[model samples]
Target: MIEPSPVKKEPIGKLISCVYRTQLKRMSRSLGEYGIGGGGQYSFLKAILMTPGTTQDQLTVKLKFDKATTARSVKQLEAAGYIKRSADPEDRRSHRLYPTPKAVEFQPVLQALLDESNARLTRDLTPEEEDQLIVLLQKLNLED
Candidate 1:
């Protein structure tokens, strides 16, 4: 009897999606301790922390998030008291996102959680593999 072709491998997109789902689940669990319930808030917080004056439009493009998602998240973060928005000085209709004192305090904690998640996810990978994976992932992200 012929061996069933060793079971066809999953497509790259499916495999990457599985990895993303698992990572996000782990991140959510880790961030829960800090009152961050998933839904990509961690990313918003981190990006704002890194670039305090970033505009919502800038974030939408930088984060590759839809405008609606970005708007909703900005509202949610504001409600959570982690971010504050101000009208852009040059653009009458644009608003810039800034991290609150609370968000500043939470930055390190969020970073630690992210680092732990990354380590856990890559526990089986060698240093070289980890570097290569990150480079390849960035390449994919940068591709139009």
Candidate 2:
């Protein structure tokens, strides 16, 4: 009978952080290759695509970003011809986000990149294993 080898453990939080940073760097490089520099801009564009007419406050909540950061991202995307903001019908003070045609046109490419990244990251995992890992990660992130 063979005894199990000692389980080597490191701080899970630090490991997760490093993984995130590395992935972010890769994403930033890819976006730069496509002439988009800001991660916030990519996220904001995704939010607009997912929820058209979303207000700045809604985007702030959905993106887990502060108001100023959300505003800046929206502004930059608008300047880049990727998005537009219109005055909210219900609240004149609020602005609703909308993806421009150019932004909508990029959706397929964006999705392809995401799928490729996922495939690369889970190269050795089966679909069920990937699903289980997602569930486990969510469980670890549970908050009251």
RMSD of each: 4.2, 3.3
Prediction 1 TM-score vs. true: 0.89
lDDT for model 1 comes to 0.86
Q: Best-fitting candidate, measured by TM-score?
A: 1
* Candidate 2 local lDDT, 11-117, one digit each (tens): 87888887767666766677766655565467778888998998889988877888898888888788878888899888899888898898899888877876776
Over 4 Å off in model 2, which ranges? 1-7, 142-144
Candidate 1, superposed: residue stretches over 4 Å from native: 1-7
C-alpha lDDT score of every prediction, in listed order: 0.86, 0.78
| Local accuracy of candidate 1 as per-residue lDDT tens digits, 67-87 | 998888889889888999999
| Global local distance difference test of model 2 | 0.78
Best by lDDT: 1
Cα displacement (angstroms), candidate 2, residue 127, comes to: 2.6
